[model samples]
Each structure stands twice: as C-alpha cells, then as structure tokens.
Target: MALPEGKMDVNLSNTAVVLTDPQNDFLREDGVAWKLVEESVKENNTIENLEKLLKAAKAQKMKCFISPHYYYPYDHDWKFAAPLEEMMHSGGMYDRKGPLTMEEFRESGADFLNVLKPYIEDGETVIASPHKIYGPENNDLILQLRKHGIQRVILAGMSANLCLESHMREFLEQGFEVAVVTDATAAAKLPDMDAYAAAMINFRMIANAMWTTEEAIEKIASS
Candidate 1:
C-alpha cells in the first residue's frame, strides 16, 4: 500500500528505523516462545518480511536502531510473571538460572543475535530496552533516538498489540512522526492475532502513517 499523500514525506536523511524487540525471545520460528505465538508470527510473516526490510534499510544507508527486551529477576512486576509462567508451562518460555547478561544471551540458544548478525557486524546501533514497560522510565529508546536527531521512525517488531502499540503511542505523544510497518510485528500468543490487527487498525487512525515495507522503502527512497 502507498503512504498517504497529504502527510509529510519521510526525510530519509534524518530518519531512523526503530526495531523493537525483534529478538529470538520473540520473532524466530525456532525461538523459545515461538510455539505459543506461532500463529501470530506465522500469519504476519514477520520474520521473512522484516528481514527483507532490514536488509533494504541497511543497503540504503539509513540509520538503524534495534531495541531488544530484557528483564531483571525480582523486579516486582508480578503481573508480567503470571502470563510468563503460563507461556513457560505451554513450552513458550525459557529462563537462564543466573543473572541477565549480554554475554550469556550471545552464547545462549536465542536466535536473534544470529538473525541480526549482519546488522551488528556492520556497526548498526543496538539499543537494549526494558521489557513490558512504556515511556522514559522503561528505557532510553526515545532519548537515544532524539540524541541522534531522528525526526521520523519506522517501527517494526514483536507483540504488536502490546509493546509495539505502547511504543507507537509514546512516540506520537512525544511528537515524532511514527510509521508502523504493518507486516513486521506479531502478538505473543496465537489468540492475540485479532487483537494485534485491531491495535494496528487503531494505530492507523492516530499514527502519522501505517505502511507496508515496500511503501515505506519507496517513501524513503524518494526522500
């Protein structure tokens, strides 16, 4: 689909692609939690489509920022723990026995590091963000983007009905032009696909624009 004609066209010279939680903990077919959310990810074709967009963005020399989700044990977020335990029970979650460590994540079975290896190797900035929280208190995603002078953000990644929606709302509230890549995000469970779709539809109303990867790329290329 094409971008809306009346909106301010993306200025690729100053645009950044904000990839949120495109991690093995979420996106990969062989990922730890894949089974629980397979339907959402599968139906959206998120991994395949996102890989295509990521490669194109990199090739076009656009600034790329990847946000991965992490959590600390005993963080007092029990509401998050219940669903997580359900996921674990259903074979959709995994946990390392020790403290969270990037080194451990790199060495672990998570496929995100391998999937995004090219971007990392090519010096793309990877910003680790907190899981399941919104706004500045959660993490410094928006601040980091602003620091880089990013005025427009093309958002993609996991849990479309939750984290993606929260991030989009925060971006809009902060006055950034936010464009959600429709085919690049999914829900945490199969049953949430409808919820994901509903959220996307709602986002389309309030966001600067909602575009497919091709439309976003063309818009960028034109700029």
Candidate 2:
C-alpha cells in the first residue's frame, strides 16, 4: 500500500530545530562513545556540520529545542534495564553525579560541547528538561515545542542509532514533521555491529526526509 502523501516544505513559523543529546559525552574526544564513533563522526564532519546548521537556524530565527540525556543518582535505582541501558548506567555515559536541580551536572563531561554552548546558552534556544535516557516520554521536549507553537522539527545530534533515532521515532509518532540531518549525528561501533550504518538505513526509511547539514541550512534559509 502507498503511504499517505505529506508535505516536505517546512514552514519556518512553525518549525523548530530539535537536537538530541548534543553532550560532550557523545561529541568530545574523551567521551565514552568516542573510540567507537570517532571514525564516523570525523567522516561526516558532524561537529562542523552541526555548528553550521545551528548558526543558520539562529540567523533564520527558527526556534531550537534540545532533548538532552541525563542520568541522576536516583536513576541507578531502576530495577531492570535493557542491555544498552544497563551498559550506559554501568559506564556512566551521561550520569549527572548530583541531584536533578543542581548545576553540577552542567560541569561534567556530559555537558554540551563548548562550540555549541554559545548557541545553546542564549535565551532563544530552548533546552527542554533532560530526558531520563533516550526518548521524549521522560522529558518535557514535546511540551516545550508545543508551547512555542511548533509543529515541525529539523532534527540532529549524537548517537545516530540511539538517542537521535529514539527522538526521531517519538517525534514522528507525536504528529510532528521531522527532517533528520544525516551528517549531524554519529553512532557507536560495537564489536558485532556498526551502529551508524544501521541508523542510516532506518533514517532513510523512516524520516520524512534525510538531509545533509548544507541542504537543511539552505532549506531553512529559503523558508
């Protein structure tokens, strides 16, 4: 059966740049996922590409939202976890090491990259309440976007197969039009699987559109 037709043109007035897990724990060299994702991130020039996308979005006055991953001390109390979730907790991937309202989490290795900080710290870019792990269910992202009257999302950010993909799935199901910036996200490479490769296949299959940063920037500018 043919899928129902949908519009691809993004209406800037109702569009927001929604990024997932743009933290140092995923982008920086010292991050836990670095060794596994270094090649893919470098190959795609993820950081520079994302910077360009962010700058363009700001210039175009497009609202931006960040769906961050944070694990507070209490999260360790969860009784059961999936393999990856268990690994994340064990490795302290995004652990905050402090209370939820404390600023200590911002000082940790899980903070957003320095280059992206200026854009994010500004009053315009809204940082949604941190997602407990990966998806929007545990976060206030959808609420934040809806409050801003957003209906479309220009999506990007870390761990293509994990957080980024999780964000994409939820956003799509929530009746939001989503465009995935393909090069703006990267993924870990495990011993038995190439996560980035896996993500690309799904990205193309599921997202309304899979865009390069340049393509997305151009579209946003034209809009």
Model 2 CA lDDT for position 1: 71
Worst 10 residues of 1 by lDDT: 89-98
Model 1 lDDT vs. the true structure? 0.68
Best by lDDT: 2
Residue 136 alpha-carbon offset, candidate 2, angstroms: 0.6
Q: Which stretches of candidate 1 lie over 4 Å from their true place?
A: 1-8, 76-100, 107-113, 132-137, 188-193
Measured by C-alpha RMSD in angstroms, how accurate is candidate 1?
3.9
User: What's the C-alpha lDDT at position 154 in model 2?
Assistant: 89
Clashes of each: 0, 0
Local distance difference test scores for all models:
0.68, 0.86
lDDT of 1 at 3: 46
Tens digit of lDDT per residue, candidate 1, span 105-128?
663433364666677457566565
What RMSD value applies to candidate 2? 2.2
Clashing pairs in 1: none
- C-alpha RMSD of each candidate structure in angstroms: 3.9, 2.2
lDDT of 2 by residue, 1-223 (tens): 7544334677788998988888887788888667878988998999998899999999988999988888888889999999888978888888786644657766566789889998998998998888876788888899998899998898999889888989889989999888899899888876898899999888777888888899899899999
